[model samples]
Target: MEYNLEVAELEKKYSNFHLKHINIKLPKGKIIGLVGENGSGKTTTIKSILNLIKYDKGNIKIFGKNTNNLTKIDREKIGVVLDDSFFAPILNVNDINKLMKKFYHNWNEKYYFEKVKKFNIPTNKPLKEFSSGMKMKIKVLCALAHEPKLLILDEPTNGLDPIFRYEIVDLFADFVSNKENSILMTTHITSDLEHLVDEVIFILQGNIILDIAKNKIDNEYGIIEILPENISKIKKEDYLKCLKYKNIYYILVDSRLEFQKKYPKLEIRKPTLEEIMLILVKGE
Candidate 1:
């Protein structure tokens, strides 16, 4: 099997916080969503893959080769939008175009110009003068101009208007349409990714809680509601987690068949990703 990126037992410690052993495999040509609460090591994982942060254990591979062995050509194939302030405040979008052209041999000027125009970003204005959403658009255009095979985005959706955020997410869908390009986007906007993400990787407190396809999650996990009468009779282990809101109980179960066997009269409903994450983090 071929993978675009893989991290096995990668560990990083910063003062009091520690990113425990992380094992992740990103297959080629897929959009994988990295979902987590604030300060959950999403950026740390992205940095580990890019070799921006030092790790104490295990190995990280890009394109099947260890990150330590990554060549210049390998670096050229991976693009990154790490943060909102990567570019100098004085540099404008036009200035960035000139800068990126020199950095990547495969840079496409036409593509860069087109994206800038499509996003309606003012090229001559200083980056600091532009709004947060405009700056993010410029960063994304810079990454995409070089025709990179993989995009590692760290919280690219932060502080953007709803319209632009949706546009940016749609742009990601267009990015992976070639089937040769892949994206590992770390974001808190799970609703924006509802239909766009191919795989969802849930990270909590530096540990991966779930790694599976979006369709599988929608089809497999369910929110089961048992009436006051049937709640006591239901097997506790069969339900993975549960919550109590007001006077009703909202239960999570992995398999509907198993849940139904025990509580045939119970009503089960499809749970959203946000709902699942809430139940995982906050128990009944």
Candidate 2:
């Protein structure tokens, strides 16, 4: 019932893009995955929540305090891993630690060093010398060094290998086990989310189209494959969305059990997060 982050009627407008009436409620100890296409305003919504940009309307609360009013201490409780934001390329791992120590009161030097060693990141090489995956690891480690209560990450696993991605995901699982911490992350990798997130939010063209528990998607939602010619056989209320490609039609239904009972001959299979997003975004 308690939420770590809440957004109501959030709106932002640009010359060519608009984020409209965005609302999100991230409860304590839960991981929420945000998914959308490349230009779907994911970054814009995050920036708005962090008060990094001006919004035309809406209220954002982090730890029950307005984002606009968060003091330095309040901000310290949140960790952020933005895709394009980090230390200067010239800073090495040691230099980054030294710099961050001066910025955060709770910076855990021992923990940070331990993770750096575990991740096998080089201490002497500048960030520019690290590979993209290595850079991502350093950013994630830095975000975790301060023991933040809420993590806001933008593609934190973007450049990691499967092995490291699994490790990072495990770390996230451990982080939220306390039930006082939470995470809001946006990733193109829906497969990771399928096993990691407690809930998922789907955004399309700057609008939040779906926000549901991951289990609901796994247990209740289903996809039905049928020939286009048989589409008329399905009642409109039975399916949430439908798409046609080549010779087949893919229909998404929220009540898979009932739908299956209604049309026993129809092929109904559980929907993955990616499949659900595809249908919601492109299906009619």
Candidate 3:
């Protein structure tokens, strides 16, 4: 598989905090969900990859070339959507088009216009007049207008409504449908990405707790809700993680066969990505 971004030993430190040595690869033709709590280094990792922050140690390779060595043209091939817009609040959509056109060698005005129309984003209105969701849509349109081979998104679904979130997720799917384009999206909203992400990369306390194929995780892991009395009968090794919610015991098991054979009294259930993540992150 061709990798779009390779992060090896990526590290950064501040006076009070340190984004410890991190490693992960974003492959082409798939959507990777970079998930973690608010302070789990998700944004820091993204910044390191984009060279927005100075790193102490590590090498990030983008499109087979080190990220530190990427030229202007090479850098333009990757589009990014940060948490906020770079455009002035008073600027209209046309101003953004002109600015980005001058900035990107491969900017497509026609494509941009088509996307704006599809999303019903008003070009005549100033950006400050747009709603949060509309502004997000504009950012997304701008990212894709340049025909980038890789898309890097940070909290792309942060403030959008359910309807628009679904629409944007479909947009991302369309973006990566060509098999040459790839996306690395970091968001706390895991359900919005449930249908889109091909791989899952979980970051916790500056460390990657889980990095695996989405299908493999789903196929191998299950949520077993067992009685509090029967919890002692189940082997700890059969489970990846477990939790207790008031009266119910939520156990996460990788192999159901062993559990089924060992504990017939337990009830096995399919788990959502959010459930798996919550349990893994809880560490109990």
Per-model CA lDDT versus the true structure: 0.83, 0.92, 0.87
> Judged by TM-score relative to the true structure, which candidate is superior, 2 or 3?
2
Q: Which ten residues in a row have the lowest lDDT in candidate 2?
A: 187-196
Which regions of candidate 3 deviate over 4 angstroms? none
TM for every model, in the order presented, reads 0.93, 0.96, 0.95
Consecutive 10-residue window with the lowest summed lDDT within model 1: 225-234
Q: Which stretches of candidate 1 lie over 4 Å from their true place?
A: 225-233, 246-248
Per-residue lDDT tens digits of candidate 1, residues 1-284?
A: 56788889988988877887788778777888888888888888888888888888879988989999999888999888977448789998778888888889999999988878887888899988988778888888877889899889988877788988889888889888987788888888788678788888888888888887888877888897655665777678888888776666778888877777777777888888887777777755
- TM-score, candidate 1, is 0.93
Ranking by lDDT: 2, 3, 1
Better of 2 and 3 by lDDT: 2
Query: Number of clashes in model 3?
Result: 0
Q: Which pairs of residues have clashing backbones in candidate 3?
A: none
lDDT of 2 at 256: 88
Per-residue lDDT, model 1, residue 27, is 78
What C-alpha lDDT, on a 0 to 100 scale, does residue 206 get in candidate 1? 85
Question: Per-residue lDDT of 100-208 in model 3, one digit per residue for the tens?
Answer: 9999989999999988888888999999998988898888888889999999999998889898899989989999999988999999888977899999888888888
Best by lDDT: 2
After superposition, which runs of candidate 2 have C-alpha atoms over 4 Å from their true positions? none
Better of 1 and 2 by lDDT: 2
